[model samples]
Each structure stands twice: as C-alpha cells, then as structure tokens.
Target: MTKTNVIRQLEKAGIPFRTAEYEVDEADLSGVHVARQLGQPCEQVFKTLVLRGPKLGPFVCCIPVAEEVDLKKAAEAAGEKKAEMLPLKELLPTTGYIRGGCSPVGMKKKYPIWLDETAELYGEIAVSAGVRGMQVILAPQDLIRFTGAKVADLTIV
Candidate 1:
C-alpha cells in the first residue's frame, strides 16, 4: 500500500512503527474485524473515536476495538459536562479522516486525545494509518508522546 500522511508523519518524527495491511470490507469496518485480519488479539487494536463536547467542541478518544467508550467517563476526563460522538458526516471535514480510518495522529488539527489505560498493558498497539485497510503498530509510549494523549479510563467493560 502507498504511504499515507500518518505513516509519513511517524517517519518524519523518527517514531519506529510497522504497518499491517488487510482486505477492506466496507460493510464491516470495525476494529475487531481489523484485529482478526491482522491475527492479533482484539484488545491490542484501538480505534480512534471523535467526540464533540457541548462545552469544548471536538476531542478524540482511543479505545479498544472490543470495547466501547463510556461517554460519561470520557466527558469527565475531558472536563466537560457532556460529550457525544461527532456526527459521521462531520468527521472528514473536522479531522480530514474518514470514519474507519481516523488516527489520533496526523489530524487536520490538533485536539486533545485520550487513550484507554489498557493500552499500557501492551508494548505496542495498532491504530489506523490515517486510511482504511492499513494500521501502524508502535509502542504505546511512543504514541502517547506523539499525540500528547492522556492515559485514562475511557473504555466501558
């Protein structure tokens, strides 16, 4: 696969990472499916989710593919009274990324990012490479350094 902005950015920053490519199934663009395709445990694959807080506008939350983001907990961590997922139609315009391909890194603009605490359990986790059908695997600490993500309880059981 041709390189995407996310890959280029990681390279430019000298962040060590490896790419994994898989077949695209437009109908099932779920992180769990991507993990299955990559032959990895679902918990190691995190999906980037964009949410709009009524008081704070847009922010990002990265959670495990097998789990869901707890909007209440996310809002609390973000210091907002409430937070809701951004409408699908606005994702591309807001972050320059499509629904299934959004990565916490290399967005059109920088927004506060939160990674589920579970990410620390692994040495490296997989996230989209700013495009569908590909993922970038890197150390969780490296990803945190690059995105300024706060490790928190962002996922639901």
Candidate 2:
C-alpha cells in the first residue's frame, strides 16, 4: 500500500481505487508524457486546476482533457461575478501545487471543487495521485465521494 496522505484518506474512507506508477522526467507538467506512459488516452487523463474568482476569491475545478472549462461559466458556478485562472504565483501559494500537479484531493484547504460533467462519461478516470510520478485510476463516483465534489456542468464548449 502506498503511504500518501491521499491514500490514507481513501483507505480510511474505504474508497476502492487502484494506484499506477510510472517513470517520467518532471520537466513538463502538461506535456502529455504521463498519459502515454500510463497507456491511457488523453481524454481519460484528468487535470486539476485551481482557479480564483476575478474578485480574488478561491475556487477549484477539475476537467478532463477532452474538454475545457469556460472561465465565465466557472465564475457562474462559483457564484462569483467572474472567474479566471489565478496567476501561477498565486496558485503556488494558495493551492500548494506547482501549476500542473495540483490534484483535487488533499489540497491545502477544502475549497469548492467542481468536476465537469463530461468526466462522468467515463466509468473510470485517471487523476493525480496527490504527488508527482504517480496517478490513480478509479470509478468516477468514488472520486466524487472522496473529494466531496459536486457534479456540475462545468464546461461551456
């Protein structure tokens, strides 16, 4: 059993999931190497984004590679006047992730995490393993249960 904080939480909550590990240089975050190494389509590889409302408030969103999160739509989802991806400088301190490796689980705070509905289209999705060099494949429903995320129409196009 892996000894990550996320793993501990999953086990404590009794969420069923499988862990996948791969070797990849950490030079790129969105360069698509992990998906290829994992033998999964890019569409099945999900990414975690930490966004803040235009008003400088906190928000979190996760979307599959198959779609993009409309910032305006995301703002509405967060009940804010507007939304935008926070600056990398801000994300590093606020979300505690280095721009690309942020996962919806085990964040610094329990901010609102909205998962795009399209993610549900896949019975299972690969998400961050709460650390670099790893990923977790699990039922989408299980992720929802563990992350306390609400399923929402998070994409605009």
Candidate 3:
C-alpha cells in the first residue's frame, strides 16, 4: 500500500518525482544514513517528522535529518508555543504511516506541512516514499505545492 496510491498524489498533482530504492539495513532511520545510501549530501535528504502541536493540531514538518529540530521554533511556525516529537507508537497511527516510511504527503488528513527554509537552497530534495528503503526526489518548491506546505524558518535558529 505504500507504493500504490501513495505515489498517485504526486502524479495527480503533476509533480515531477524520481524514485530511488536501496537496501535499508536494520539501523537507525536518519537523514545521515539516507543521504549516504542515496549518494547525496545530507542536506539534500529531508526527513519527515510528525509532531503534535497543541494549537495547530497535527502537523508534518520536514527538515534535514542531519539537523535537529528546534521544538519551540517548530511550535512558533505552527502558531503554537511549543511542539513535541510524538512517540513512534503514537505517530504511526496519528500519521497512518510508519516511522521510516512516514511521508509529508499522502497523510490520513491534510496537515499544514512546513519545510525548513534551508532546504530551498538545493534544486532537488529527497524525502521518504511512504516506505523504508525508498525515497522520492523532486524540487523543493514542487513539494511545497504537492503538500500545500508552507516554506518557513522552521529550524532551531
């Protein structure tokens, strides 16, 4: 189910995307390893983080896994005082996707997605493809449109 209709969102939105598959070892699912495996810089690989905000409902924020999320900053971006990284157990059901497979797109509900401004520095960015061992590469701006995400300073600045 991860690959089936998950990618349809990209097509329906007319978003240009490319697929990269790799062997996902039983290791920590982080941006560093993903970038290494994909043969791309860590900054080019975006990690989809699911956080629960008190005021903004559930929101999906994407940032370089190489960089840590500024919880308070994320909260402010979501118009809240703070945000917390939800537990994997809580996140799976809340997002209707697994941790390593969680994508900012194709969610159970439409969330206000936010991308760290730094990600826009690159012409291409990589994100999880609704499954582990898979990534989809596309323009950062296209991702903003596909997910209707707001591009903002969502970093720990």
Better of 1 and 3 by lDDT: 1
Better by TM-score, candidate 3 or 1: 1
Top candidate, metric lDDT = 1
Task: Tell me the tens digit of each residue's lDDT in model 2 across 25-116.
Answer: 76756626778778888777888877787564787888875567788878887788888877888876786666556778787788888888
**What lDDT would each prediction earn against the true structure?**
0.95, 0.77, 0.84
Reference-based lDDT, residue 15, model 1: 99
Off by over 4 Å in 2: 54-56
Error of 3 at 89 (Å): 0.9
Cα RMSD (Å) per model?
0.7, 2.1, 1.7
lDDT score at residue 84, model 2, on the 0-100 scale: 81
Name the best candidate (by TM-score). Answer: 1
Question: lDDT value for candidate 1?
Answer: 0.95
Q: Clash pairs of candidate 1? A: none
